[model samples]
Target: MRSLLLALVFALVAPALPAAAGQTLTIAKARALPLGSVVTVGGTVTTPSGAFESSFFDKGFGLQDGTAGIYVSAADDVHATPGRRASVTGTLKDSFGLLILVPTDVSLGRQGLPVFPRWTTTAGVSESTEGRLVLVAGRVTKAPASDLPYGYKFWINDGTGEVQIFVNTQTGIDVSRYHLGQALLVTGFSGQFDTSYEVLPRSPHDILG
Candidate 1:
């Protein structure tokens, strides 16, 4: 009787399981996919410098592609570190307006190379460009000043307009790196900060002189 019930349960549930779980998705494709869908995405970890195990993040790191990037969430520990190629399987989750992946499983492959940034102006940074890994070049208008209530962030003006650029403590960047009146070119994942949007740069390499 117990054995029969186990078989019956598996029969009923197996058909409902995702069939295309093995299909590979790029960061851009995954970002466009509908919420709650389970898909495998391939990308390179770009932030935290190494494996991320944070109370706020749970356990995960940032993943990026030539077109875009997204935060990957691990329920527990994350083995994949920055620059490592990751074949990640997860369900798309909108965590309180923040798009993150809840990873079911992740397999690391070859080391990943950096992606070319998508060129765009400050005026072009809109909802359409959200999550895109892009480059915005302009003068440091406001310099390293916190427009937000707090954090290592500043404003950049690409002649078109202004966009906030944020660098986390883990990225090892400082306000001194950005000089006022200097022509600056910065790259990172495009995301939101509160109701306003912001750009996140992972390292100095992102800021071209």
Candidate 2:
């Protein structure tokens, strides 16, 4: 009788247990979950670890799968580079306006080619593009009046609409060469800052005029 009672107790309590670690969720599905929910996602690393000097991105990197992409924050603990496949478990967060994952555990997998940048128009860059690499070509519609402490901010339009291009100072990409009306081909990670959606080039090579 005691054995049966114990078995019944175990069965009743098992349903309340949290999910096992490492049960993977696609990047898009994880993004849709409520904040503070623990989730595990597997994807290819889109940005090199420690690439951005800002504390906001320090130790963090970007990851993307077939469904979507997302930035992993405060993940200096894991060694990741562009093209590396990784399985990360973390809690979802909204840093400023950008959605990010704060990792608690990370596991690296086989290396592969980095995900190709998707070609899209300036206006095509929306919430869906965030955390993914993209290629855009447009004329410089608005040039930076002055450089901000973080970097330069400019606008580009490809007739469909206009989008902001933010050249972070840490990347050492000089924006002075890009002037108003100049046609430019740019490749970068589609990201957001506060309320504005912007493209962030990883290096000077990401820009071609």
In terms of TM-score, the best-performing candidate is 2
Model 1 stretches with alpha carbons more than 4 Å out: 1-19, 48-59, 65-68, 75-83, 146-150
Candidate 2 C-alpha lDDT tens digits along 1-209:
99999999999888554456667888988888878989999999987775554535467788999999998886464668889999988899888788889988888999999888899999998897998888999999998655566678899999999999988777778888889999999988888888888887878888999
Instruction: After superposing candidate 2 on the true structure, give the runs of residues whose Cα lies further than 4 Å from its correct spot.
Output: 1-20, 55-57, 75-79, 145-147
Give one digit per residue, the lDDT tens place, for model 1 in 71-160: 777766656656788778889987646577888988777776655567989878777777566789888887786533334677888778
Best by lDDT: 2
As a whole number from 0 to 100, the lDDT of residue 87 in candidate 2 is 91
> What C-alpha lDDT values do all the predictions have?
0.71, 0.84
